[model samples]
Target: MKATRQLHDLGQSLWLDNITRSLLDDGTLARYIAEDSITGLTSNPSIFDAAIGGGDAYDAGIHAKTLAGLSGEALFTELALEDLRRAADLFRPVFDATGQVDGWVSMEVSPLLAADSAGSIAAARHIHHQGRRDNLFVKIPGTPEGVPAIEEAIFLGIPINVTLLFSCAQYQAVAEAYLRGIERRLAAGLDPRVGSVASLFISRWDVAANPQLPDALRNQLGIAVGQQTYRAYRELLASKRWHKLAAAGARPQRLLWASTGVKDPSAPDTLYVSALAAPDTIDTIPEKTLHAFADHGQLHGVLADDGGDADAVLAQIAAAGVDLDALALKLQRDGAAAFVKSWQQLLQRIADKASALEKESQLP
Candidate 1:
């Protein structure tokens, strides 16, 4: 069996970490969904930036929106929404088959609002409505301020994919926010099955810790953190509090592993995919990693529910003088900033493309 199918059979969801007009126009995304067990997809400012700026796939839509007097963020949103809506439609059947648990496509709110709770909530609602698809998730960062917005968006029935989490503590905060939202829904006589996922980034942890660790610990911190967080996830789902919420018709907000692609060229390409496998969890992998896994990646045994050897690995790193907590914070902050940078560059690239296209058209 293909490793992607093996992973899916082992109960880990495989979601494509990309979306683009070309992928949609060329049917590549659909093929992955049909053949590679890619039940879902996720997108962000960076992914969209690369997709739109890397080629002319988005030019016609950008030109039309430009003619309609839309530019900057507004123009970008319209273009992004077009791609996301199409991707969401492609996965709708999987979503329906799984009763809303599996197939989902995520579009992030502006990274500029990462720390703006009110603004994030407003933008989330706006984006969710604009997408108009039941399977769409608006991604919110898991920064301190973003926690409240996550809860508010969930309580308001806007499904969310909480992103940029880097450690167990960050994951807990996002989970608590999700629980609060579901609890509020129960109180307000709403269905408590509103969907959500707390996305803890994996590879960035190792990247952030690389320079601080010795040779033996290289490329190991991220999996250790993921193991610890997955342990927390299992414990949380089985707890009395979660059971109480479950009894009230609330679905457990799933733990997702984001940034699963290995960044270090020397490491195995499917390092994160093989190590972090667990039931009831989602791993959104970059397109290259997904293909690599399907081609030759091995499915190491699934992660231990009890966080097998996680503490020991973490303690070894700690003994080496790495502060996991501080590192998590730094990675989260840096990831948000990186997305903002990508967002600005994306806008500039789109504007330049629009201008060039106009000039070409005027060459009668």
Candidate 2:
């Protein structure tokens, strides 16, 4: 069997971390679903910026929308939703087969709202409603402020992909937020099948720490953190609190591994994919990493439920003078900032494309 199929059979979901109009129009996304066992996908401002701004694929569509008076985020929303809607439909079979456990395409709410609780909640609802697909997850960052938004969205029965988590503590915060929302639903006599996945970003730890670490410690922090978080995840699933919720028809909020692409040139291309393979968790893989793994990636072993050597590895890093707690928070903050920048750039590109297309329309 292909390595992708092996991972899927072992119960780890592999979601492509990209979306482009060309992929959809050219049957590339569909082929991924059929052959690669790619049950879902994820998108952010960065992904969309690359897709729309890097080409003429969206120019005509942007022009029509602009001519109809849509502009800025509203115009971008119309374009993004169409892509997400089509992708959602392509994965609908996996959705039904997994009983809504897999096959979810995530669309992030505006990065500008990352710090706004009310705005994040409102945008999540609006985007999820616009997509009109049960499998679509509105991604909200798990920032200090975004947790409340995640809870509220869950209470309203919106499936969520909690992004920007980088540590065990951050993962737990969002996991509990998801539980609180489910508990509130149980109290209010609402169905508690609201889906959620707390996404922990993997490679950025190494990226952020590389300049400060020795060769012995390079690229190991992210894997250790992932192991540490996975231990927390297992404990939560086995906890009495989760059991009670489970009996009451609540689903366990899954742990997801994000930013799984390798950044280190000397390392294996499938570094994160091979290291973080575990059942019941989701690994959203970049397209480059996904194809590399499918072709020649071999798994040495899957992660341990008890978080093997996580504490030891972390201790080693700390002995090297790293303050992990401080760095984790910084990484999350920086990630939010990066996404906000991308969001702004994407909107500007959309406006530029729309204007250029409009002027050209007048010439003919």
Candidate 3:
């Protein structure tokens, strides 16, 4: 059996952290679904920027949308919804087989609204309503502003992929937001089992903190953080609060490992994928890493529910002068900024493509 199938049987999901028109048109996504057990997908402005800016796949679509008077965010949203709808349809069978617990596709809200709770909420509602796919997860950052938006969106029955979470503490914040949202749903006599996932970035910790630590500690911080958060996740799953919510038909907000692509080439290509393998969580991996793992990844063993030696590793790093709390905040802020940069670049790519397509049409 493929290693990807092994991970699935272990009860963890493998979601592709990518989307593009070519991926959908060329049957690559479908092939992954069949051969590699890619049950779902996730997308952000950076991925879209790479897809649109990197090729002419979207030129005709942008031109047509431009003709329809859509520009800027509107044009981008329409394009994204098209791709997400296709991806969601492809995963619909998995959605049915898993009874709606899996088989999902995620599209992020405007990064411009990362700090605007009201704006984020409005954009989420608009995006979800327009996408019209029940399996689509509208991603919102878990920033202070975004936490409330997650709750509000969930209360209204929107499936949310809470992004940009860094530490166990940050995960706790959004986990509570999810809980509060479900509690409100129960209060309103609505089903509280709306799907949600709190994404904790993995490889970025090594990318950000490795330079400040000893060479022996290289490429280990991220996995340590994963262990820390996994402990929190197991604890939450076993908590009385979760049990009460479960009784009311509320599902647990799944823990997702984002940024699983290895930043250190010296590290194993499947570094994060193997080290962080745990059941009941999700790992949304980049295409490169996904294929690498399918070919050669091994699940050494599942993470310890009590967090194993994560505390010792973290303490050693802390003693070496790493301020994890402060670093977590910085990573979250940097991530939000990076998305904003990508969002602007994607919009410009759309505008440029639309213009070029129109000029080509004007050529007699």
Q: Residue-wise lDDT of candidate 3 within 1-364, one digit each (tens)?
A: 8899999999999999999999999999999999999999999999999998878888888888999999999999999899999999999999999989999999999999999999999999998899999999999999999999999999999999999999999999999999999999999999998999999999898998888899988888999999999999999999999999998888899999999999888889999999988999999999999989999988889999999899999999999889999999999999999999999988887887888889999999
* lDDT, model 2, position 184: 97
lDDT of 2 by residue, 222-259 (tens): 99999999999999999999999999988889899999
C-alpha RMSD of candidate 2: 0.7
Whole-model lDDT, model 2: 0.94
Error of 1 at 335 (Å): 0.5
Positional deviation of 259 in candidate 3, in angstroms?
0.2
- The lDDT values for all models are 0.92, 0.94, 0.94
**Better by TM-score, candidate 3 or 1:** 3
Scanning candidate 2 in windows of ten residues, the lowest lDDT window is: 355-364
Question: lDDT score, residue 231, model 2?
Answer: 98
Residue-level lDDT for 31 in candidate 1: 93
Model 1 weakest 10-residue run by lDDT: 204-213
Clashes per model (N, Cα, C within 3 A): 0, 0, 0
